[model samples]
Target: MVIPIFLPHLGCRDRCTYCHQGYITDVSGEDIKARIDAAFIHRAAPCDVGLFGGNIFGIEPAVLEKMFSFFEPYRDWVRAFRLSTKPVPLRDETIYLLKENKTDIIELGIPTFNDAILAGLNRAHTGQDLFDAYHRLQEEGFSVALQFMVGLPGENENDIENIIRNMVRLKPVYIRIYPLVVLKDTPLYTLYRTGQFRPTAFDDVLDCACRIYANAVKNGISVANVGLTDNELVRDMVAGGHYHPAYGFLVQSRIFIRAVEIVLKHLGYPKDITIILHNADIPLLIGHKKQNIMKFSRMGVTVKWVPSGNNRGHFEVRSQKGSAAGSVQDIYDQ
Candidate 1:
């Protein structure tokens, strides 16, 4: 298990268009050390620690060292450290400090590859900055993960394609996809209030996210997460954008339905079929509120599912006419 210690805008130089981490995180700066101590105290065993919220790379090297010092007392119980930050202003001194510490993974937030979108978000960094930081981290033997956002102002399908292409090319250890949510008091929220920025339709944003996620899986890059964690603060602060409690599940269900559709097409649109999959994936196969089953019914196909001990992401569709076996990866391959 990994313990998350939220810094909550601790090192951020400037806020992104949609970022209001103070509300999302609800973590106070004064309680950081206390939070660390409390987390380690309840640990049953050594665990990985995640330093989340805020731009860690933007901090000065000296202050960064002082920040790392807080965890020194719990070094024995700490397995490794993972931190998230923007890609720019990644100084060599910061890289050396991360290496000296037990920080093994660095998650860079690269919202988009389009320079115009980056400027619109006020990220103060370019796509090239992400590439440079990624290579530098790789040279220092650090595992890299990427964080991407969808549904930003002025984003388009081509931008989503760009994300997929770059993700496949860079091949980070894992990735997280977040649909943009305009929070109260942020610039994005102001635009939403003034009707200056209008988010794309919810389904359209979800489809865009699914394309990114599917491409990542097909390329053998792990997708560690798909949406922001749901909480009361998030629910209250959400002013616009694609914020759903079951956003991740929705993406998985869409991918699963796509895979089933591919298999059915290969089977000549069978009238009846039994889907054999790992027990854990039943929810995805059934989908939220049985939507997948309803979709099959609407397509003039009868579907039944049986749990199997087969590995997750593995499924077989058998019909009277024929049978086809495949996974989500097959969807992209075809």
Candidate 2:
């Protein structure tokens, strides 16, 4: 069973320019309890429950006390509890309080650690604030996950590398990479409208993701999420900036591209080959916007994704009769 708890914009003191979540959730205590109870009946996730959204750290202590009370019934079944909050949420007293609550993990959205960029985004806390929170949380014995964004207005490309370097220095157990996604109805949208903000380009996003991917691989920190969860499929979405729901799969495919380079060396590479993956993973394997499949075709590789074996995450590629012959087993072996 996988149960994801989204409180969505509950306790934020500073409503970020891009935030619409303030209109999207139940901020009241009774609503929180009701939502949790309703979720239990249909939830399929294991005991792990994720707490996300609405300034989780900005709220009062009593809110959390009651919030935890709602979880007491599931404590035995719940193996872990995780939550995501702004990077500024990390305070010494907050650290002590979270420890007392037995939170297994705290995901801090550091967005970008660049001081100037932080101000540009109106991110209330500083890069120093993030590190302060991180160190305090570590000392108190909690697993930390840092979430970062790339390509904010006024930030240079080098800032991406710096963010990665800082995270490596921090040595968190988990991380999430979100290229700057421009959402509407927020202050960012206004900035975008006024030409005050410019999103990172797609090519740059791919390039940055590649660099971050390599460093994450070397660092051994699990990249839990690599992109946006909701793509532009929603009708009401305001704007687009490297927004793709299947961003993780694209990053994985990019990783596979690296692997393909190695595999082609041994198996006379074909100009085109059809890659078959399980049907269940069509969204992830094909990519959020069919970008992966299309991109491969444009690169002169005939990649075709077909439904196959029940293995959820497994994939196999076949070359057309006249195209070439590379062992599917060989690719899988790699």
Candidate 3:
């Protein structure tokens, strides 16, 4: 469940180049304080209260302390409290504050790890800032998450690799990848208007998503999210940046296809192929929208995503060349 609160959405000491404050935080004055004090503390909502919107701890330190104090009593009642903040908020003191408040999880909107891209995006911090914050939070025993964005202006495959490299160094408990998304009334929109910015292509972003997810899995890291949340209003408001309501699903489906491609290259199938996948990821490998299935069919691969009781997110691809199908033997040979 999502529990919303009003604060600086980006929550930096100052707004960055692509900040849209109003759209993110629609609360004002007493309403904001009241919600933080009441809804998350006194009032009964969902068990999970997300101290969300912008930077959760980005207010004045005093205000931050007050907000923390307000929720102290109810900390145990709630199963978990997720604090969303800027990467800099992972400083020594900030981690202590979160711990004191009994925060169960912490997430940073890192955006990108490439220093040049981050500077161009006006992220107000460097890749080191993320690493420092990440390490500090970990030493303090907090569940840490690092968020990265792809397909921003000045970002290419190298920039993407940089993100992966830096993030792997951090080894965050949760990793979220957001494709660059443009919104109205932001610096990015202005750049787009002047033709200085071009949104990443949908297919390109999908390919990147597959690599990123695969890398996380290879490293035994949990990819908490792959793309922006699916919402029609958000999609409609997206003026630029690899924005698609179905993009996340497509990315997941592509991951399955990528893995299947690897399997096929090894197995050498020349006919219709049936791929059975682990139950947990069946929806993703086949796609929630049957996107992967269609893509597979178009490529002359017939994938039948079935439950694999013995495995999760693992699949077997069967190449049907009638009775003469020789690919099955390749699986045994491997």
Candidates arranged by lDDT, highest first: 1, 2, 3
Indicate the TM-score of model 1.
Answer: 0.95
Q: Per-residue lDDT tens digits of candidate 1, residues 60-100?
A: 79877877788888888889999999997989899889888
Q: Model 3: clashing residue pairs?
A: 9-54, 10-54, 182-240
Using Cα atoms with residue i matched to residue i, what is each candidate's TM-score against the true structure? Answer: 0.95, 0.76, 0.83
The digit string of per-residue lDDT tens for model 3 on 104-143 reads 7788788777788788887777878877777767777778
Q: What is the C-alpha lDDT of each candidate?
A: 0.89, 0.69, 0.67
Model 1 misses residue 11 by how many Å?
1.4
Q: Candidate 3: where is the Cα deviation over 4 Å?
A: 1-6, 21-29, 37-46, 72-76, 89-93, 279-282, 302-310, 320-334
Which candidate, 1 or 3, would have the higher TM-score against the true structure? Answer: 1
Question: Per-residue lDDT tens digits of candidate 2, residues 1-334?
Answer: 3467778777777776655664754478778887788767654545777888666777677777688789766766677778888766654556656766668788888877788777767778898988887887777788989888765677676787788788778888988887776777888888888887777687667667766765775676778878767634432574867776656667666555544444444446667666566677566545546666676677666665668774644555466433322221222110
Q: Give the distance in Å from residue 317's predicted Cα in candidate 2 to where it truly belongs.
A: 14
RMSD of candidate 3 to the true fold? 4.6
The parts of candidate 1 lying over 4 Å away from their true place are 23-30
- Maximum-lDDT candidate: 1
lDDT score of residue 182 within candidate 2: 74
Which candidate comes out best when scored by TM-score?
A: 1
- On the 0 to 100 scale, the lDDT of residue 30 in model 3 is 53
